[model samples]
Target chain A: MSHAIVAPVVLPALVAAFVVMAARFDLVLQRTLSIAGTLTLLGLALHLFLLAGDGVPRPYLLGAWPAPFGIVLVLDRLTATMLVLAQVLAIAVLLYAVGGWDRQGRHFHALFQFQLMGVNGAFLTGDIFNLFVFFEVLLIASYGLFLHGAGAARLVAGFKYVTVNLVASTLFLFAVGTIYAVTGTLNMADLAVKSAQLGPEQSGLLRTGVALLLLVFSVKAALVPLHLWLPGTYGVACAPVAALFAIMTKVGAYAILRVHLLVFGGDDLPTAGLAEPWLVPAAIATLLLGTLGLLAARTVQRLAAFSVIASMGTLLLALAMPGPAATAATLYYLLHSTVAAAALFLLADLLAERRGAVRDGIVAAPGFPQLDLLAGGFLLGAVATTGLPPLSGFLGKVWILEVVRAHPAWPWLWTALLVTSLLGLLAFARAGSLLFWKPAALPAPVDPQPQARPVLPLVATGGLLALPVLLALFAGPIGRALEASAAQLHDRRGYVEAVLGPGRSAAMVER
Target chain B: MELLFASGVGVLTAVGVYLCLRARTFPVVLGLSFLSYAVNLFLFASGRLVVARPPIVGPAAPGYTDPLPQALVLTAIVISFGMTALVVVLALRGFLEAGTDHVDGREPDREGRS
Candidate 1:
């Protein structure tokens, strides 16, 4: 609502659109525009972080219209956090892309900014219909990024990515339609208020609509059965591009989190009452399959993609757990997993370049000490992936365990978590052996590719690696903040009040 | 009227699913496109089909159809169009490079095996 909240989202959007129409020039100007825009956005994120302590849910009304009639953006604690994350990742990827600068440099940077604009906009927007709009924008930009400067492999994979997303978008539309027909509004806050008013008679249709909505997100989030597109496509995409897309899955997870917190109210949704629920089972299956794929996979990129699936399972486990701690744990794991996945993808890209090969399978490309850099990053990331200690990942698991410990259904969930985590650890350990400890005698004579000068990617990779560890150090404050976010999210009425204004619930119900 | 529309959707979904399970990439794409149509129509129907009342809200239209669903569905239509274009291009590229659009990575075997 305040100037601080609006600036980060608005500035990048303006710059992105401007660059799209700007005169084509040398690679330097294009890179400058992107780097400048991202730097501005990052500055805004830090400023908003400082202002978040002011304790107001900042609202920005686009085009000067009221809440229900117009699109409004909210800068809450969660929204600001996601904004900063998006900017941080965007900057890293842009900097990394500089190493590969060619004719495609301008278009790549411009599209990347547009992608961030869509992401930050989606995070902040107050209405459901607007969320769909932002999602479409993000997807369109992703299509461009996915196929940028790759061979036929990327083209095929990009097609699958677009098709799957289109199906999900259609589902999103239908869910919105059904919800509006029942509730007469599309504002998320309004939906929350109106959904609560459905009497016992109308609960069936309402539940059905919510179920349909979750199905849409399930495909987007790459839940086990629906995740076929991710590994193939992400494995095929260029490294910096794949690293950028590492944030895409998080967008879907964030959507699921928002829906649970806002529309489903964390207590009254269709899946709320059932113990030994479907998501828990689905999540366990996902974790097992992902870890298995990690162990079995020969390619660096596919291994990282499967690792993402495993992390999603952890987040879902948190969701399946009962009460507030589950939500808090989901937040913690989300941050940890996203940072780790991005770093791994970046490292994979670096390895691909350094070894002078781009094959998906790990062929022996005479080892370099630089390989150790990737190996170490991969190990730390893998440790986080398995929820090992001395990292943010472990702290998140402990938080979830503390909450789920006393529940009557604790044993099954705990066993699932513990076993799947061990499987993850084993899978990564196998990958490390295959990658790093191959006999030193087999070193083939080096015929490296014309060395492309790379500086920014290394810096970006190092930054991403440092982030989770740094956050781990500040876990107490961050955890307290996450707990605050969880409490506010659980208090559904506070959200509705923030968006729909006070006392509008009673008035809407009388209709 | 609603039942007829619902049946149409069901039929579309059934055909799409069947086609998608086929061996060729073209058929799979067609199947996906068919399924996308069904999905979009189904979503539009979720707001409950109302004849003749478009979702336009103004002073004269106090009892207008729900504008929210219309806006959302409109956006979906444009996005689906983009995705379809992308899919077509991909299929073309696949056919060009690999000479066939089969779902499985390999060509059919010589011993009457797929």
Candidate 2:
């Protein structure tokens, strides 16, 4: 299974090519191949997770090339955890899409397969420049998917999305060039060693590079000042695309943790604690904006979009501090928020169809079919999203609160956390009563058309909504796994030696 | 030489940012291209400038430029090229669909234009 490290990246890439080249003529064939490839990827991801469970960082050198001289894909607990989470989200989103979304857009399945290939590659790559390549891979596929079943609104929004990401990519190259100039290598582990040992003159340039890198990642994470792109982009996307996009923001958070924490994190490094000053205040602002925007949102889709920003706010807040407790909480909250946000988006789409003219707007509509089932799903998703009790959101919030109690700005953090949770609860409750309760109390309007809602998409939404409950039930084991992942993440020396080998022989690769 | 190269990058970036802030998609697309050009130049020079040296590793070579930046620059150029093509097509689509070239897809008022 030594090759399992590469399977998550390689398998989907090959599958994407075959889907385009062989199955291009038939939709049925494309769906079958795409779904089968995803399920197999799930199995490979799980096997790799078990492999990484021993707390060892396994670096797979491509083409038998030595470290620092060739590209390496490192499989560790952190990468494996992300892979499993991504695949699970992909399956649910795919199921929901096939219920009819893929039919609306040409080449959805092919683009989807390529998207998975890129996400998996991004998670596995050990070289910084390779990560840029994977980011472009995923972003390009996403641009196509973002405009799937294109409309005027979507095309306009897609323009801005593409432009924003293009700018971010340019900044990414600028940062990488600066770092390469100083460190002379783009291998992350080697950079960690070289950057830490740099003299003061080089330290200034390195910090500037690190700061620019932070900007690019934050744009992806949707942190404040750079988060203007999220609401517009996610709100207008097709539901399943938005659902899959739940992990996209998490990719940004993952890069921050991987690069900022492990590569240039320690006291000896020039860039140590660089993200700390910016993360806390900006995260809180992001959370505040999300809460206020929730009440102001006209469409439930926009509401869900803002909720993503808020959830990232909480995740990034935990990310501000790097300890076993905080990092573990960050990881768990990351999982819960992604599943919960996806559930909200799917539920919004379902409601959109039933409401007809209102089409996902918060205004009340007459009773629609399966109101009770849909209502229940909304309530569960809301509970999870608003951090209410008896679900994973509340659990994650409690963990975060405990860990952040030691921060210098604990009072501001607590007030922001508590106030936002209350307001979010109120927003959801008001939206629910208007959409579900008021409609139920009123008579069912005489309808021009009342189509029987498909059962498959409902089942998919219900399955995603149920994950929060499952996460709560299995909190102990999942919590332990994340704790171990956090420990592995913080132990920089272990990661460095794992990638570069003992005696640090990467210098020999130099000309 | 350093001052010239640094100022060149700075000026390209300044122009890029200025055009990017314009209210039309055409300017934004052009700005993105300019920004990419600046970045490509910056990446090419990251290994430091050298003259009359081969990049290969051989005993006869008196000196060598860093070959890695060349590789990096090549990759950056290809990606940026593809990205520019995609964005231009997208901007064209937006203009066709919305029937306006404004970045926000709405025509500006006469008063605002003035």
Candidate 3:
């Protein structure tokens, strides 16, 4: 069972190394190895999910060292859920990349595998420093992936992305250093215990450190005033890579949720409720920025990027509120937004491929072949992104609204969400009509060249588009599971006890 | 001694932030490198700057330095080194491809459209 917890990280690392060493030049072998590795990871994620569903937080201590000393990997319901989401998206993006996208750049397959390894490690690791290492692993891989096709625009965007993140990484290290200086521990559970026992002066320093940490995560989450790098970066990235990046922001959200709720959540601690004051207003501003960006975007890819930002805003708004209901709503909305954003990116790529010179620009160009299929995909994606009815987007938003209705900030939250949804609807409607409804007046080409759409790419994208549909269908069981996970998250005592043993956390509290 | 280290870190970070806000690629990369050095020092100092003490545990030793921060700083130094190298390469690539070193990839518009 412990091995299962490690498998997701280990398998990808091994496969990535093998691909670099043995299958460097063999595209076929690399593809086979990559796919097989991701499939195995998906299987392991599902297995871990089942094991975690029993409500036990399983902690795997490395080298048999006890808590606070060893590197640990915890497989709780939240981690398992994240692992499955990441693997599912990885497999989908890998399938799409296999349709000649991987050949566009060197080391694409290896970098993709390393990226998965980083993400999985981030989700599983129980120590904060390990989280930083995994974050770098994933970030470095993302940098390589972002520049895969290597255009001038991509190069420039990649430069900005690297610079911004380097600064953020520095801040992360500084924050970690401060926390360690004050508390002398980096393990999450130990920090939980130590933080609660801090004296007044120590509490002030710890609060500063915790605040810095939250700022670092906010940058990763692309909260407004820090989101300038996202649109440009995602806009210039290739379609499949952009699709994979949908989950990257969610990784930041997960860090905030996990660290904030677990380490700084004690009622008597000065750091308790630290994030709430800042997160809500910034999240609302982010929503506004996203909506305005969507309205002004001239291309499908940029519009899709803005929608991603908007969805992140929605997720963070729920997260700012402290309750199991809000956490559950955030998780459900997170799942829906990730899938919808990825599908939109892929669909934009498909449209770009078909339109040739127009390349997904929001202009009425002559309709290309496979019009029906492309139109249907775009419509479904548009509906999902705009949070229209009969999709998980709608369900997730309704759930969040319902959960936030009783909060003191309910009026502002409700207005921002509803107004933004309306604005998003208008933007998508305009984009859809311009791209699909308006018929161009150009005559048919005399050459009559027949372009064949690859069956595999379509299948890959179709599979992603089907997710929101499936989410809505199984919302009952999934909602229940998320509620249970959120309850477990809120029950910080259980987590501390699980990792530190039954009496240890209680003993610390007594002292 | 601690005051000197703190001021050094502060100066490095301030200069780094200033350079990072510049509109060119090379300066920005250099700034990031400087900021990383400052952070590394900060991490090292987190162990409380013990002097004349061994890092290893010894039965006869009076007191030893906290070895964990050393380990962390070593890992952090290696990671930051790699990061700096990667950024330098990326900046060079951007310069080569875009025919300019401006971080925004183009000359600023007369109307300030960026």
TM-score of each: 0.91, 0.98, 0.98
Candidate 1 per-residue lDDT, tens place, B1-114, comes to 988998999899889878777777788788888887887787677667787774776677546665555566676777777777878777788777766676543478989475
lDDT of 1 at A4: 67
lDDT per residue (tens digit) for residues A1-511 in model 1: 4666667667777777777777355467777888898998998887776666454566677887877778788776777777888888888888888877325434787778778878888888887778888888888888888878856566656656776777677667767766776777777777776676667777776666677777777777777887888898778777788888878888887887777556664354443433235567777777777777777778888888888887787777677665656777778778888888888888777766665553435655456546666778777777766778888888877877777675577898688778877877887777677666662546654654454546777888888888778778999898888777666666666666666677765523211
Using lDDT as the measure, name the better of candidate 2 and candidate 3. 2
Q: Give the alpha carbon lDDT tens digit for every residue of B1-114 in model 3.
A: 989999999999998999999998888988998898899999999999989999988999988999999899999999999999999998898888888999888877889665
Error of 3 at B39 (Å): 0.4
- Per-residue lDDT of candidate 2, residues A420-511 (tens digit): 99999999999999999999678878964766667878888999999999999999999999999999998877888889888673332211
Give the lDDT of residue A223 in candidate 2. 97
Ranked by DockQ from best down, the candidates are: 3, 2, 1
lDDT at A300, model 1: 82
* DockQ for candidate 3, C-alpha atoms: 0.92
Query: What TM value does model 3 have?
Result: 0.98
- Give the range of the ten consecutive residues with the poorest summed lDDT in model 2 chain A: A502-511
Kindly report the TM-score of the first chain in candidate 2: 0.98
DockQ of each: 0.54, 0.92, 0.92
Best candidate, lDDT:
2
Preferred candidate (DockQ higher): 1 or 2? 2
Error of 3 at A474 (Å): 0.4
What would you estimate as the lDDT of candidate 3?
Answer: 0.91
